[model samples]
Target: MTDDRCFRIDEMDLDELRDRTRDQTLIDAFSNWIRNFAPHVDEVIAEISAAFANNKLRDGIGLFEATGLDDYASDEELRRLRASDEKLDWKRISTADLSRCYCSPSFFDPQGFVFHLPAFLIAELNDEHPYGFIDRIYRTEEHPEGWRALLTNKQRVAIIAVLELIREHPDYQHELDDIDASLERFRGAQSMG
Candidate 1:
């Protein structure tokens, strides 16, 4: 018998990310956003390199910061990120490694955020527990005051799509207030573009 029951986005298998399953519209939106923003591996790498060169990585405690012995990321997680950048494959990152990016939105400058954004989007659509992903959307004040302004129109639109996705998800009903607040801010930003 066919498994006709609907599944939550976070409950699907990783391979099903593009399988036209439940939440396909959100998946396609995220995929299109990734393709539009991070179309080239070289460009992505260049952005990451610029962030590193410009000291744009953020000043707050990152997901990996102060990990005396209990590190949030693997010792090789950074290397894996570099590898993924070279390959343009978000799936190369393990869930734990993806958490490092999603959990610490303040750790990335605007450019760095752009670089890792696809991963955040993918994790949001797939990970069972995407820690801090929701906060990343609504905790706009945690980032530099000018951060939102630095994002390109396409990037802002991508964020808007994700916000809407979360706002409509039943699991996120409790976060409606914060999601609505962020939606307004982002929509306002979009209009100014």
Candidate 2:
């Protein structure tokens, strides 16, 4: 006996057809799309986050070396670094700059990493926020440090998501072009200073 009855489709309205057609074939197609596309987007984000983290580490190391400060440098030393009279090249400094001088476990925490970033650099990052929360938090004076902490967390998450996308779809690597453009803009601003 033939199984032709399994393939029969009665006439139906658009909505009815859509409802009835939600079968294994449709479900499998949706699943395939997610499997194929989601990862590429995620990979891009993760790579970006890793890049940012690496950059932070580099900045912290540079700071320690330039200042000749030990990891246990006193708060006085840190204050002096932040002071205008120190003539510190804030623009050229980064989280890595601080790492060389400090051995604190908190220093490596990605969320606390923002503390190593100069206020101005943080401002730039906020300026590029795809969401308004970064700008809003940065602008508010109620709790500057807290705001930075929040932003650091938010950025880390966003970058990780992008990395996941990149990982999923190597073919869509070009999706990083926009991120590159944004980075170029930031770099240009730095050069101008």
The best candidate in terms of lDDT: 1
Residues 134-185 of candidate 1: C-alpha lDDT, one tens digit per residue: 4575764646355667666666676676666556544556788888888898
TM-score, every prediction: 0.51, 0.25
Please report the TM-score between candidate 2 and the true structure.
0.25
* Clashes (N, CA, C under 3 Å) per candidate: 0, 40
lDDT of 1 at 132: 51
Which predicted model would earn the best TM-score? 1
> Runs in model 1 with CA error above 4 Å?
1-96, 100-104
Candidate 2 residues 1-193, lDDT tens each?
A: 1112111112222234346566665444334434565334334434444444433332232333224343555777755653421123333543343333333212323333343333223322322212212222222232223423333444444433433333333232344554444334334433443
Per-model C-alpha lDDT, please? 0.50, 0.35
| C-alpha RMSD of candidate 2 | 17.1
Error of 1 at 180 (Å): 1.2
